[model samples]
Target: MIKSRAVIARGKGEPVEVVRIDLPEPGPGEVLVRVQACGVCHTDLHYREGGINDEFPFLLGHEAAGVVEAVGPGVPDVSENDFVVLNWRAVCGQCRACSRGKPWYCFDTNNADQPMRLEDGTELSPALGIGAFSERTLVHAGQCTRVDPAARPVVVSLLGCGVMAGIGAAINTGGVTRGDSVAVIGCGGVGNGSIAGAALAGAEKVIAVDRDPKKLAWAEEFGATHTVNAAETDAVAAIRSLTGGNGADVVIDAVGRPETFEQAFYARDLAGTAVLVGVPTPEMEIKLPLLDVFGRGGAVKSSWYGDCLPSRDFPMLTNLHQQGRLPLDKFVTEEITLDEVEDAFAKMQRGEVLRSVVVF
Candidate 1:
């Protein structure tokens, strides 16, 4: 067993604390990771607030890059000292979706079966099946995806979650390609990623929509050709005007609210795809005109982890990072110690940062 200091959230709105926790040795098919860096993601905050579920005593933090410290029996893909980014999708091969060759939609994805416990013996629930807030964590072997050793942990760690979501939303879910006009609603990390993905896919015109002027400007760096400040004007109108009043070839709603969803719905060309990349709360609901749903001859899809296949996407994205094409480094707005996560959460609530990474 190993004792390490980690961030632990007790319940909804409860405070997070630096507490000692016990991480046992890796069991069968498990790998122990010595986390190098972890990003402060909105989803972690959501998990802290119980917005995700009532699973309290949560071990917070995901979006991590690390070095494999130890491996259990039969784990051949990753070895000690390998640099890797952690993934939540520890896909189960025999699952209904995986059996159909769609491992991206694996329903039986899993994490470490044994819990990391607090010093007092309280088992802590790791966030997103990762729990990278700690100095070390145990995860299913399948969750480990090797990346380039030359890549910096702080830079590549962002791709473990939010960045990957945005890129995959545009590339895989939205099917963005050369000459496809794309619009992204909400210019946060995910939104900016979508813009970058569209640009990488060679989208001719990429539109960005957000209420914050600063975020709108940030979107431009990610290849947004047009920006719409919803605070100053109707977003749908701006997107339409930029797309020659025909709506965009693809519209991705990164905000995940019913209102933004409606905007994405109306901001797509007829028969164009609408990708909902943002996660929504249970209390929230979307009520669109039934007739419009029937009249719009396109797919309305929700992207979970951007429908990514970690083994394939991680190395490719890391190469993009190495080649200086993907601005994975830009997604990291700041770096802080794990102790600063509480204040980081506050900044996230105010929409003041894209990410505040915890560097070991």
Candidate 2:
């Protein structure tokens, strides 16, 4: 075991605490990683706020890029000194989803069986099974997806979560293709990623809908063809008008709010696809007209981690970034220390930055 300073959330609605913790050595099927950089994802904030669950003193931070430092017994594919991006969904190939040949939807996922503990020996729950807000972390071997070390760690880490979700929503779930018209609601990290994905997939028109002009500007940089300020106009009407009065071929609701979902529902062309990539609170509910649902004649789907297979998509996207084809660098607004996570959260809430990455 080794002592590592880590960010820990002790309780619900409590401020995160940066304290010393004991990290255990990796066991079978596990690998130890020296975290190089980690993205301060909104999900980390959600975990601290207890929106995710009651698990606390939760080890916070998950979107990370690191180098393998050690390998456990029986591990074969990875070795020390390899650079990798951490993934939450490490597929268990024996699961039903994998049996059906869709490993991305694998029913069972795995993580490090051992737990990191406090100095007092109190067991700590790692957020999303990653717990990467530290100098190092232990993870299942499958959680490590090797990538080109030349890529920026801060930018590539974002792909392990929100960015991947957005891109997958457009390219994988929504099946966006060349010449298709696409509309994305919400201008956050995930939404902007969808815009990029749509652009990469050769969508004829990529419309960005959001309340913030700053976020809309970022969307344009990521490859949006048109912008709609929802606060100033009817989003559905504007989308339809921009798409030749027929609505977009695919509309993605990245906001996950009832009103925003309703807008996405109506903003699609006849028989067009609707993808919901945003996460919602449990207390919120939506009551859509059943007739409209029947008439829509298209799929309304939720993208789980962008329905991405990390092993396949990670390398592909990283290669694109290396080739200067993908603009991953646009996502990094600032680099921060682990101690400034709370401040970073404030900046995120205030929309001051796209991502505040913790660079070790």
**Number of the top lDDT candidate:** 2
Model 2 has an lDDT value of 0.93
* Model 2: per-residue Cα lDDT over 1-360, one tens digit each: 888889999999888989999988889999999998999988999999999999789999999999999999978888999999999999999988999999999888999999999999999999889999999999999999999988888889988898999999999999999999999999989999999999999999999999999999999999999999999999999999998899999999998988888899899999999899999999989999899999888888989999999999999999998888889899999999999999999999999998899999
Which parts of model 1 have CA positions greater than 4 angstroms off? Answer: none
Checking candidate 2 for backbone clashes, the offending pairs are none
Model 1, 1-360: lDDT tens digits are 888879989979987898889999998889999999999999999998899888789999989999999998878888999899999998988999999999999999979877899988988889999999989999999999999999999999998899999999999899999999999999999999999999999999999999999899989998999889899999888888998998999999999999999999999999988999999999998898899999988888999988999989999999998998988888888999989999999998898998899999
